[model samples]
Target: MLLRLPTSVSEAQQCLSEGAIPVGGATLQWAVWQRDGFPEQAMSLREVPEANVLSAEALGAAVPLHRVDDRVPEVLRRAAGGIGTGAVRRSATVGGNIVGSTLRCLLPAAVVLDARAVVLDVEGPFETDLAELTAKRPLLLSLRWRTPQASGYRKLAEAPGGPPPLVVATAVHAPEGARPRLRIAVRDGYEVLAESVECDTGVASVLDALAGTAIGALPAEAREVVREQVTELLARTAA
Candidate 1:
């Protein structure tokens, strides 16, 4: 396989236009490689300067999970730290975590934070909401979001070191005078179950309202677990 390492976004775009598959971190690509073999051509975004930017409001796609520091939202930092082992965290890129076929901790955090993704495809660069970005599977350039008033994250795995079956992220937004708006996102290993913003409803009522929406697809036992965990997370963040 031919691998193209581009130092600039334009160079990377050219490689992409030539049909090179964009690779960030290549952690997820390991599974793809094992299943489908390597692509004929691959472009590494790690060397692209624009894909390395990091700050309070923006994180480049190639930025490693371990590099997600306190400068970003607390929920994001916590989610990044909890992804995997130290080595895995050091190697996994934010973009890969967000767009990978398997849901990762960062996705729920990004959802609650309302992050927007910048993507580069063969046509050129474009920006889209993170909620809508993953399905296209484009080359993510970076993610940007405004800081929230407060945020929290939680995850529940079946085994000691197994992949989490459920993960939840919550953000509290207090508009002047009105009740605090609570944004919640839940994910089970493969897809998002629910993402919505609620106001004024107590935890029980909110869970009831979500009975047929976010947790509807889950089995009865799994739905109870989600409710319990989501209630705990919401209580903590809402406190």
Candidate 2:
């Protein structure tokens, strides 16, 4: 297949509008082509010069805009189970997933943190709510909130030979005086979805509810043996 990597969304869209299938990262497309039919032409946003990937300083400076990442939030030690394999996560990016609206990835984590996505095109820089940006527009950049607290992730796979029917992530934040923040993300039906819960809960408790919500939100046809799987995986990260 022919490959074209554009430096900016306008260029990428230009290629796509011209009939090329522009992909932010090739892995997701590879995942499809590997099991499905042959793809003719491909363009990537990774090699593009104008890609808005951020630096550590940039992540720090964005605090005023989002105000969530003000402290050193605990980095998640464990990730939800059944989210592809190690290789996939290693190469995958927050920007890539958000732009493509790749479900069950990490957008939910950002959403719960009240993160803002920084988007830019030939026009200029714009900020979008993480929840609506991915689904609505071409993602330019994802800026997660730097907050005080901890978070965890969980997921249930189909079986030893199958892919996951559900994935859940819970983010708990210790905002100064208000009730602890609980945010949950679920891998449901065709896309990944999320919701927020206001409570005085800990990270572990938040994850437990998130695990249930993740599975419960799934379509009935998609639920079954995985119920037990959810409990098992969630317990691993449960406090």
Candidate 3:
């Protein structure tokens, strides 16, 4: 049997307690179904949650739960691109992105912004970093993060439309009085995070330096052209 619950985690838990698997988003399940034709009892969060997953407020804002077919911003859509195809985006939940750490995941952005997620369980509401929690436990409810300065997200696709094989860098241009921050996530690959510098100077120089710095940190010797392109983009943006 399938069960649908309100967007609240308490409601979700109620279903889980009643022997439901608690499918926040159907991305994973749908993927299995599409590829392998697996059939199983499934619940949809699309309708019960009111078809919303995110909302912005004044630090006390509450977001409604959502289901499939709801539209979001281009940036958000891109951010949720970890799920890949169009069908997945429609049915996927932000909570699933938080849990799976899929391509173009939004949690990284939330992490960059120092956001917190309010997770409600049978106990009560608990707060934590959306990204950090993904590293520890699967998120039980929602995620929240503070706004960043200037934010930039770039993905290095393997082929033309393939998943990123290298790095998907998400940067938060530090607040007016703060230092710039960057998160370079390397997929199916590894990057050195031991030492790095934060620049608040001109954008061109930073991008140039980023390429060389990143290249220096890498182990593979495939090519050095990617660095050059990144440096060039930084230059153009700075210009």
Candidate 4:
């Protein structure tokens, strides 16, 4: 078992280039460590200043979920705060949420945020638009984006209240006219099923649009309930 804790981004990048798996806040890594003990090569990012920084210069990927400022962009803050529980929030980093699983909410939120995710390899920094990473899994170094006017997010789980199957995230910025520009991303369980940029003038319109995109993936009985909840959620946020 071996652990390399890097104090700076370059040190972390150097370790990663040497094939160490990146680990920040170990929430997702614990299960793997339990089964595999220590990985053949591992890097712990807890002490890395780059991994904990959150600001206009750094993206959410390096930020700890609980430490994000609530003022930067409301949607991102809400998304980060929703990762798991209090304990998980303390340990989980945004990069983990981005690449962790098929059931994560951050990527969809990233779409609405129009975020850019970066990866620093030994070759230097390689960047990709956030939307590009939704389908393909990419290890991230930092995530950056411009803050919008207002944004909202909703996660709906099955009866037990465990991992959610459906997540609806929206971002709004005032356009040239009366209606605000809307960007939305919808995830049903394992994959992001759909995303749209449109002007949804009313709640019914938004419900219809999301339902049309995600209805087939959800159970028949649950569709109406989803619609109801999504409607209320959008309306509440809009107001």
Candidate 5:
């Protein structure tokens, strides 16, 4: 069990280039550690200045879930609030939650917000769409977005107020009379996004059109359940 906590970004980069796996809060990393034992080397961004910095334009990779409080936009704040408890939030990071995640709460929220993540490696930083980064599992540095006007999220868990087996999120950018370009992500394990569809803003009509269009895989019953949940989600954002 070897660990290196780098106090600076350059040091962290050096450690990563030397083959150390990055650990933020070590939530998932610990899961891996318990199953497979610690890797030969691991690095922590705990001391880096940008690791947990949060502002209007961007959130640092290591920003803990708890810090993303109500100051965040509703779509993100609402989703972040659902993640475990205060203790888990203290450790789980925005970056850690998105990258290599099986059932992430952030991906759909970020994608619907049109967020971009800055990934760091030996070469340098590169930008990637937040949704795509979930599968790519890059070494994330930060996530940025301009913000969306209308966005919402909902989940229908297997149990009452439990972890959801299905999650849905929607966002729209519309000005004046222009048809809104709706972005949607429906999650089973990973999220599946719809190409921004231009359509009327009538909630029922839009939901009807999108229910069949965005989500590709689902049994008849599950789809109906999603439709009901999405309707409720839109209601919140609209209000």
Candidate 6:
């Protein structure tokens, strides 16, 4: 494999234009390489200054999961901190978590938080929703989102040290004199589903409304688990 390490965003983009695959942390890419062999050309973003930004409202693509500190939202911090073992968290990048799989812990949180990704393609830098960015498989530069009024996250694993079967994230925003708006994202070990609902009556009403929307895509048993966890999350964050 021909590996290129660039120090700036422009240099990285130039390498990308030359058909180099962007790699962050390489934790996920390492697994892929182990299974399918390394790509012909690749660029590591670790040395790119722009890919290391971590602030109150933005995170660079190469920011390690372990560095997701108190500056970001509570739900994001929890998701990042809970991703894997301490060593894995130290080695995994936020960009890798988002691009690697929809089942990744940070993705559902990104969905509910309305995070936008800054991406660089053949056309150059542009911004889009995280979900859309993931679909295009572009080189992610950074992620930005406004802090919500309240947020919560939950994960369900089959056993200790086992992969989580379900991951849920919720964001609540209350407009003056208007009903609170609740947004949710659920990953049912297969797909990430998201929806927004107005909390008109209570958490139960919100649960019932989601029964036919985002939560509906889950199997019956998974649906029940979602209902229970979402109920608890809403009660706390939306209160």
Per lDDT, the best of the predicted structures is 6
lDDT of 2 at 67: 24
Error of 6 at 91 (Å): 0.9
**Model 1: lDDT to the true structure:** 0.79
**Candidate 3: residue 156 Cα off by (Å):** 2.7
Clashes of 2: 7
Better of 4 and 5 by TM-score: 5
Per-residue lDDT tens digits of candidate 1, residues 25-104? Answer: 88878787879888899888888877998888888989999999999888788889888789998999998888864666
- Mind sharing the TM-score for model 6? 0.86
Q: What is the number of backbone collisions in each predicted candidate, taken in the order shown?
A: 0, 7, 8, 1, 1, 0
- State the lDDT of candidate 4 residue by residue for 118-149, as single tens digits: 76556665788766665565557777777666
Model 2 weakest 10-residue run by lDDT? 60-69
- Candidate 3 residue lDDT tens string, 1-239: 44455555456556544545445456565666678764434433444342244544112112211331124322233455644676656655666655543443554345444556665444555776644565665334554444443344444555775544553333344557666654333333422121123644654555556557544456443224334433443454355
The Cα RMSD in angstroms, rounded to one decimal, for candidate 5 relative to the true structure is 3.2
**TM-score of each candidate structure, all chains considered together:** 0.82, 0.57, 0.62, 0.77, 0.82, 0.86
Where model 2 places Cα greater than 4 Å from the true spot, the runs are 1-22, 30-82, 101-104, 160-164, 191-193, 201-239
| Model 5: CA > 4 A from native | 160-164, 175-179, 189-195, 199-201, 220-239
Per-residue lDDT of 40-89 in model 6, one digit per residue for the tens? 99987889777788887788888999999989888899899888789988
Model 5 TM-score (2 dp) = 0.82
Ranking by lDDT: 6, 1, 5, 4, 2, 3
lDDT scores of the candidates, listed in order: 0.79, 0.51, 0.45, 0.68, 0.72, 0.81
Candidate 1: the clashing residue pairs are: none
Q: Which stretches of model 1 miss by more than 4 angstroms?
A: 34-36, 160-164, 175-179, 200-213, 216-239
After superposition, which runs of candidate 3 have C-alpha atoms over 4 Å from their true positions?
A: 7-9, 30-53, 56-77, 81-83, 101-104, 159-164, 180-184, 188-197, 202-216, 219-239
